[model samples]
Target: MTFTYTVSPKDWLGIAPIVVLVVMALVLMLVDLVLPHAGERSKHTGPANFTVLPAVGLLGVLGAMAAAVTLFFVDHPTSVFNNMLGADAGTLYADLIILAAGGLGILLSPAYLKRLKLVHQGEYYALLLLSMTGMLLMAGALSFLIVFVGLEMFSLALYILCSFIDKRQTSQESGMKYFLLSSFASAFLLYGIALIYAATGHTSFVDVQKFVVAQAHGHAPILLLVGLGLLTVGFAFKVSAVPFQAWTPDVYQGAPAPVTAFMSIGTKVAALLAFMRVFGFALSSVQSSWMPVVWAIAVLTVILGNLMALGQSNVKRLLAYSSIAHGGYLLIGVVVSGAAQQNHIGASAVLFYLTCYLFMNIGAFGVVSLLERIDNTGSDLSDLRGLWYRRPLLAGLLAFFLLSLAGFPPMAGFAAKYYLFYAALVGGHPELLIIGVVASVLGIYYYLRFIATMFMEGREGSHASSTHAAFERIPATPRPTRAPTGSLTRAASSTRGATAVAEKPASTKIAASPLPATAEIEPTHELEGWSWVALGIAALGTLVTGVILPFWLPQLQQAAQSLLK
Candidate 1:
């Protein structure tokens, strides 16, 4: 007997998102090379003089997003290179979220880099495109080999992006730590793939699924279970869950804010989407084995991520822990999808929550980045004190994003969490719902602390501003001259005298000042046009999408139905 193999155009079309991203990445690289010193010279000057690299990179990311949306309408999932990549609506949506996050990262980078005085403008934008491309590929890959390839691509780009600030030891330390741990995790993941291939003589997810189902009662089942466990550990590290999450806070603190913002969402989406696809479609027959494991992981991750975040005075660490907590919440959707046997409603919940997560998480980080001093440090919560008094619009947006993250009612985060729990309940997982609710309650403390600080606290002492090395080091712009020591001491003494008697009463009556009237606001010399615009866009997009999710859920459900098919 003879066997025939066939491939079709749909297979080629399936890879369009990756193709779009790669092509745009090349375009950004070429632009970087071709742009004359005219743009480079402006780097030393004010924000108005900065180049259009940010805009160009964003256009590329948007183009990729558009292509991904178009791919959703193509109505077929296709596997290419002998089933190495699987492109479907799920992959398309995941790539869209990654691309959108990358675009925002590009927008935020210039201001961040400008502040740090580290200007390799071209390469920063290029690396973001490249990293986004890897994430897109990872989202679509159907075979273990392809998944590994895509994972490394994304990881490598991120390694470089993390260490982009050559001047900062913190950035270098973060890059090295991520690279070492990630390499170790990838080895386990690849070993698991090798073991699976050995048992079934196939690395494609579809083939692996068939093989597992066929040998459900045999020794192959044991081997497959071991491999799956190893795979789970690998992804756990990437998404920073529980014990595997030790690296997240350090990495977030060390890397530039924009890079951290981008990595937090983009990496999690890619990794978790693959986690769901692997277990949901491939190893689902043995769901009983992994379900309990993921269940335990979910509960622990939620509780630990939130509980640990409660004492955080460092803003980046707080967000990092929050990201881990949200990872657990997203995992609830993952588990629901895994356990559900009927419609793809559970998978839809994962998609909706991830989509909402990208916006809200990135928006909050973008606000933190905006408040950071130029050298990409200074992520302390104290920096955000009185933010409402200085920039009420930005502060209000940040508050909204935080509340959404805490899963408060009526916001998109609430809707996403509601669907996630509802999907779990529909699938008969009440324990998961209880854990989620409890975790959410634990999340309240740290989130509210920042909110309270912004509204209630006075601005930090003027002495605090001088501690920012990035700000003090900006050579072209002169710093405000300080008063002589004798005068300063007298002023301090006078203020202390005035406050001593009133301190208790003053604290109770202080209302958060509305944003200073625009005309009355002090002129901040170092504000970069592109950076501020990026922050604005991120904040605005988050609010708009979060508000419209109720309207979008129907279409999202339609997309979800396709995944179940």
Candidate 2:
């Protein structure tokens, strides 16, 4: 017997974003090969360096965004490729979020790579776009097979990107750790999918939902329950909830800052949306079985994430913990969405909160990226002391982002939290509201501490002394010297007015210049034009979302409705 499959033009349209990204990534690789290296040509030449790669990648991302926007407005929710994927408002929204984050990450990368002398721009942009494609695939996946493929696709790219900073041993360690742990999680997820298929004879979400509904009001099979438990564990690891969160801080601190910023927002958006789809819709009939477990995890994540962040002196590690806490907040929306009564409200809240989070989180990390040194040093709290006195604009922007993350008034974070707590109450889970409130209160202390360190604290002499002490510890290279000076040398020195000019090698000229005091260190001097553009976009996004939130609520509601359908 022979089998045949046919694809429609509309199917092509449904996947336009992925197609564009993949093609552009290939084109970029080819372009990189043809372009001359920086040493081979003059700096003024357009292709002399990798500068054009980022611009091309950014254009690709914008094209994908346009396609996603068109699909979203067309409002045609359809299952394509034999139900392997689905296109709807929720998927489109997730795609847009991922693309925006990817674009900002690309914008933030050119300066960071150049400053650190990690100039593999072609590979960097290609991997970024490819990983984004995988994220979009995961968001739209309708079957376990597609989910596994998308998960592995992005995970592999991220593992490489994590270790891209070849000079840092910590970067290599981070890649190894993520590879090992994430592979273990993927195995568990796959096994769970196998068990689910064995028990229900289905892999598609729609089929699973049907089977679950039919089994409602009866005792669920032990195999099915076990599969669900394993699936939950796998996803919990991906989201960095509590005990599974051990890898987050180390990886975030070691990886390049642009990579961290991208992963922090993009991975969460994709994984959380998948979690909602699988648990909130597919397995929602068995809510009574899983609700308590997820509830405990959510509470623990919020408390532990906030508590751990309080003692962190490294900005990257602190933000990693902050990401974990935000995951807990997102879980509240997930829990409420699973409730049969007010699912739309909870679902809409999740989408809106993610939208708000993308701006503030990226903005915060952009500042950290600027402050980082080429050798992977800096980013310590002491490095930020008296920041306002040095760079007022960056200091003020960081303050704004920190305030938003702490859920201050007139920010999108506050609006998002209000919607989430409201959904919890309406869904009859008032306890979630109480826990979220307390967690947010505890979170304020750490966020404010960072701001206070930058503005209220005075520059201490210890920092300068420590820096100078470190500088003095370096062993100076010995240079060849002439024999003891004779009367002729003395006569020549006298002829030169007793002052001899030393002729040093060209390479040492820059190093021999007077070093600034540690208290006056200005890391932002390394920032390039593209980095500032990214910062501006992130700040504008933060302000716009907060100011126009009321006008955006109804659209969020519609997106939520489409997602549930």
Candidate 3:
């Protein structure tokens, strides 16, 4: 027996998106080494190239996205690289979603990192790009080996990203917990892969499909059955399904908001796509064996996840549970796609919903990331009270995203859920649709609750302390227009006189304390330029995807046709 090997330019072209990202990650770290003020930046004492590193990362993501889009025009087989990768339309589509998430997540990062005084600029962007590469790899995987490798690659990057804020204990805890639990989940998935290899003597999806179809009884063997169950547990944890979701709220709450923002879409898109490829396509011949278990997880995750989210006061935790529930909604696609009879409706709906979700969900987390101050403060319900009064733009955007997440009409979230539920109904899973709608209704109360807090007349707190709560209660004063030269001279003279007096004596300080040069007023910080870019794109996407979904739906459905066959 011989294991044939060959490398072609076309093979590299098939994985061009991944290759671009890997190159960019290394380039970013190297670029950081040569930037001005590198030593001061590392020590957190001077000006840093806050603009350059994130910009480089964004360009890399854009490049990867371009590579992925180019693959749409290239003719490629279902599997490439010795049957380890997929270059089909579905893989390309999923790659676009993952890249979109990575791009938006990078846009949200620089400001958050700066605000938190996290000065590790180079490694941060590098890991982010590397993480996106892993997601792209997972999206294109056709073999169990590639899937596990991709999972670990992305998961390891995320573990470090989650703990990047050295000043925060919560961040460290989040990273550690994610490392431990994810490793445990990886073990289950890997063991399942090993058992499947033993049973079928293959690891590629094509080979596994052939072996499963060749089985005599139209049923799975006991070993294959156990392996499938373990596979379910592992993927279930990855998707944050119920009974395996305890880590989600904790990790989401503890990690930095931008990291949470990225993982919400990136991790789910990668994990669910792989899950769909494995169960919905590869082992689809044994659909009767795995569908019931996936169906059960979906139902519980949809219902229980919503129930858990109803009481969260912290913005991150609320979104975490929301992410978990949405994961269940996405699983409906997997459950239904197992039936080759309905064509690829489930897979297409998954793709379409993922596109919509990337906008609405990331925008919501982007706002949270933008709002976070020192030590990860300013994300509580109390901090959001009267937010509309303080930052109407942010408040309005949050409402729009929350409404979308709640499946309200006219928002992308509504459109995403509609297509997903339609797929469930069309695929003969009416029960999932019914349960999902009920859970979504439960979800609305929390989203709306947070919205209500933002719109409150004033944040509920006293003015004794100079905290964000009190800051929200204060009416924003209009900044006065610049004065003429003569008036400015007079004002400057008066300010100097007052400062001189305040510095002179303790008795003069009593009268001029607020006017003292050292006395500082808490600034009503403006949204960072990069964050505005992210929010603008997200807002536009949230609106446009819903409005244009009808046009795009058919195109996505055509891409999904490959999976069901």
The CA-based lDDT of model 2 is what?
A: 0.79
Candidate 1 residue 74 C-alpha distance from true site, Å: 4.0
Error of 3 at 436 (Å): 1.2
Candidate 3, poorest ten consecutive residues by summed lDDT: 499-508
User: Per-residue lDDT tens digits of candidate 3, residues 176-259?
Assistant: 999999999999999999998988999988889898998825689989998888888888998999889999988998888888
lDDT of 3 at 185: 96
Model 2: clashing residue pairs? none
**Full ranking by TM-score:** 3, 2, 1
Residue pairs in clash, model 3: none
Give candidate 1's whole-model lDDT.
Answer: 0.74
Candidate 1 on 176-218: residue-level lDDT in tens? Answer: 9999999999999998888778778888888888887888742
Q: Rank the candidates by lDDT, best first.
A: 3, 2, 1
**Candidate models: Cα lDDT each:** 0.74, 0.79, 0.81
Estimate, for each residue in 114-170, the C-alpha lDDT of model 2 and write its tens digit: 656565678888999999998888888888888888888888999999988876788
Best by TM-score: 3
Candidate 3: residue 10 lDDT (0-100): 77
> How much is 562 displaced in model 2, in angstroms?
1.9
Which of the numbered candidates is closest to the native, going by highest lDDT?
Answer: 3
How well does each candidate superpose onto the true structure, as a TM-score? 0.85, 0.88, 0.88
